[model samples]
Target chain A: MGEILVKEKEIVAPGDVLASGMDYIPTDGAFRDGENIVSSLLGLVYIKGRLIKVLPLNGVYIPKKDDVVIGRVSDMTYSSWFVDVGYAYDAVLSLKDASSDYIERGADLTTYFNIDDFIIAKVLKVNKSMAIDLTMKGPGLRKITRGTVITITPQKVPRVVGKMGSMVSLIKENTGCQIVAGQNGRIWINGTVPDMERLAVKAIKFIEQNAHKSGLTEMVKTMLSKEAKK
Target chain B: MSYNKRFDGRKFTETRPMKAKTGVVKNAVGSAMFQIGKTRAIAAVYGPRELHPKHLQDPSSGRLRCHYNMMAFSGSGDRVRPGPSRRSKEISYVTELALSPVLDLSAFPKTVVDVFIELVQTDAGTRCAGICAASMALADAGLKMKDLVCAVSVGLVGGTPVVDLNYEEEAYEEGAVDIPIAMTPRDGKFSLLQLDGDLSKEDFEKALALAKDACQKIYEVQKNALKERYVEDKK
Candidate 1:
């Protein structure tokens, strides 16, 4: 709980008042009465005033052994299917990663992951060959059926998803939209309808706009409510 | 003037898409990767701890040393070989100067604050971008500072001042010259200065004004990148 001055959506300037704490301010904008004026971006708010691009501020989403990632089946082979994780190379979630599930030789593996079936799988291995092996046996790590997907910068995926899912949890509670967030910036929203999907995207943009500031929860709820009515 | 011209369409001022990343590496106190158009840099911050090479140490306060290096492969043509060149040395000292003004060095006595920057892609203004990235990396390391310092290269293209200088927009100017400046927009202090071509005192002042204004805008991106890093660390 922090004392916030400028309300969400408030237009701030280069010398405007931001906050009073060890909490750091983003580099630019604003004013304060007898206090060290911080930049307008010193804290978070809900306005896409003028932004160039999303900034990544965490450990890069590098594929590690045994990490779960939801990927879209992009290409298929006689024995393997390529999944796009928005990386330099599409990760190969092979049949080997799938439950030691028996399969006929040379059969259409696309049936397991037809062109565009969303899958939740774990990385069994990534060889020097840059081949990514995936498996599906863990909880919540299954095929995705129907939902609207939102793509952000893969580098910015962590910021949108938040820590331990706190940010996404906030979005879920506010919009009631079931979300399938991928580390690669592919966000699927099981919104009741397209409206919910659009709302989810708008809310995400809202989070991104003011993510540098404090008090994110209240701002998100308000954006969702207003968006829902719209 | 072509119909498909930009605001002025003089070129050079056309900033391409920008990209930035923070904490791209581990085992470092703080790190960031920044790109503007085609120019890109990865900066890592280490220290505010015991100084090495005791001779270069400052007794009363912490000293900030910056190394600005370009990857041999960063440049498009001949690979940029590692090791400090004249430009790299000059840029390093200038960047060190920029960080010094806003740093609360006395907060950490007899220590060294180091900024290691690698320009992975060189289009133009890599030093300025490196400054912004290193400053944020210092913040990402949670080092105490009075303010976050940002830098932008402003060039005169047909008499119009541009914010962030791009590739063809920087070098090979026809009637334009580029002036690179580092300023803490919040404090209104100029830290680093580098110039190319020619400009009257009037154009110089005008470019400075534009640089400060642009610094404010750039500060937002710098902050967002840092916040993106901070929030992740918090999580």
Candidate 2:
């Protein structure tokens, strides 16, 4: 029989022994070393049946296919626009995928998406060399304007989104703000009143900062309600 | 002449007091400051981002570059020159070698992870201190690492095996052999070993053992520093 050394949700550093024996399998941020399973990251421990995995607490934004992300236009070629999605490489937004409408060759691309413009784009493809291709034709994908942008740790994006987006909806309902959260950890918030936008941003940041804790939903709710009155 | 008591009145196998903290540099992706006795090293990790100088990009996996430097007034004796020297270049190369084994950069092709280590104070074992600080910073940056790296200077001070020889011990009249060592604690394997003086085979083996034991202690400090950073955020 295998022995599980760490409890569920326990924080572990790299090389920490997670389990000891062949009956235990390692996956994701955990790895097998001889007869013992070891953690390969500084993260929370998770176990499912005999399989062990670690969810990282911190990391840079790695681009993935089909992930919605917000990017800034850094440069433009004659046929495509280079969008920086907070990754090591800039994603390309080709003219054809730039929009549903037809664009002429050598068209003044600046008129459509100028440099420094922020746009919500979807990852179309990521090659072996990590070159990313982005599309702007998807639903809810458009150039963002008249909103303040904030960034948080990319690893905390799932927490900010919450279960079926309940957390985001809570913030929206309480603050009356239009918000878009990107998988790359950028959030766009716009509201009629500056104070409401600030509240939403505060809530998102709160979630990001306290993503590792349990009962976060209740904590966030209490915080939002208390702040809403003042 | 015989070496009886330590110059600092420490035990033969004792290292100086250590202090470590992560996320010290707010602008960096990850950063840490490590101090041992009078020696202090601060390390910052910048990327798994694109590698510039077009030709240096590796298509197969990412590369790691380390920069080790000492401040102008950090040295105990004289002012260090501002720019990179031959000695700094060598230490930088060794620091990279000391850290690369545990780091898994295969997922980031054509990119580079840069580690900059600055020695703010120096008594002895500056390179070893830098390696320890750099390792913690890399982990704080969320880089995939197999284990934390620990380092210390261990050697024969007048034929007595000691762990973490200070500057005065290195300059002992009876002569001292300063051997700086770095280890991957989980595996108990040496990643860095450099000797500055001569020692008998038996003495060298004893010193190596002392270094191994000292490294384990340093590992605990490094691990706690990383965990404590998150613990403090909860309050």
Candidate 3:
């Protein structure tokens, strides 16, 4: 029988033997070498049934289809707009995907979306060369003009959003700030009181710094309350 | 007379004390510092982001570029030039070769992972120290790799095999042969091997065995350093 070598939630480095034998399956950041499952990244080990994978604590975001991302328009072509979505290559936003209204050919593209303007976009496709296609025609997808954008490590986004977005909802309910968190780690915060916006940003950063720790939800709530009082 | 006693009072199989730490540079995606005796090297990892110069990017796999530099006052010899010298350039090229075997950049096509290694102090084994630090930094950066690489210099000090030679022993008038070796400990594969002096085939084999053992010890230090980056935070 195959034997698992590492404990659940144990931190593993690259080349660390996670399991030995063919009975176990490896996925994600873990791979099979001969009969042994070896971790290919420095991260924590997670085992479910016979499937073992390592979840990374840090890394750049690779865009995926259907992921809602916050991007800034870097340039415009005659037919499409190039959005910088924190990837190696710029994502293309074609005119048809930009809006529901019919835009005439060669019409002023800047009037619809200009350079340096941020928008909430959805990834439509990613080709073999990592070329990305983005669309802004979706619910909650539009130009962002009235909020301050802040970024955290992409790996911490899941934690900042929390389980079913409980963490973000808590922050919103308490601080009365409108917050939108993109899977790419960019967050837009808009609030009536500048102080509350600042507090929400601080709470998000605190969640990022302590993302790996347990009891993080309580800690974030405590921090938000203390900071709001000042 | 043949060289017998080590000047520093270390055994033939003993290496100088080693110290290693990860995440030294706050701005870098990954960074580390490694010190072996008087030699110290710091490395920072960036990119796998975007590769500039449209022509150089490869569609199938990412590129690895290493820059090896010694601070102007870091050398025991005369002051180092501020810019890249021929020796530094060669070392940089070899450093890349030493690290590429374990690194898997297939997931990040058309990009580059840049490693910057700076020597803040020097004695001997600067390249080996640099390789160790760079390996840790790459791992800390969350890059996928087959295994970590460990390196050490093994040599014959006048017919006696030594695990890691210090600067004084390298300059021993009686004659010493320094052979720097880098290995992927798990696979027992050699990624780097360079000879600076001569030795008998028999002595070379013996020293190679010692070097392999020494590398295992260095590997332990590297593993501990990486784990400490997270483990220490638990306290």
Best by lDDT: 2
Q: What does candidate 2's lDDT look like per residue over B56-110, in tens digits?
A: 9999999999999999999889888899999999999999999999999988999
**Model 3 interface DockQ:** 0.76
DockQ of each: 0.02, 0.71, 0.76
Clashing pairs for model 2 are: none
lDDT measured at residue A118 in model 3 versus the true structure, 0 to 100: 94
- Clash total of candidate 2: 0
Q: Which CAPRI quality tier does the interface of model 2 achieve?
A: medium
Off by over 4 Å in 2: B233-235
Superposition error at B152 for model 1 (Å): 0.9
The segments of candidate 1 whose C-alpha lies over 4 angstroms from its true place after superposition are A1-34, A37-230, B1-15, B158-160, B173-175, B230-235
User: What's the true lDDT of residue B125 in model 3?
Assistant: 92
Given candidate 2, what's the lDDT at residue A110?
84
TM-score of chain B of 2: 0.98
On residues A1-230, what C-alpha lDDT tens digit does candidate 1 reach at each position? 22345555443322344554433333322323233434422233432332111122322244567766778888887777788764435777667766567888876665667888888777777664344677776677777888777665444566677778888887887667898777655677887766667777888877755555556767777777777676
Q: Per-residue lDDT tens digits of candidate 3, residues A22-45?
A: 999999999988989999999899
True contacts kept of 2: 0.56
A141-217 per-residue lDDT for model 2 (tens digits): 99998888899989999998889998898899999999899999998898999999999999999998899988899
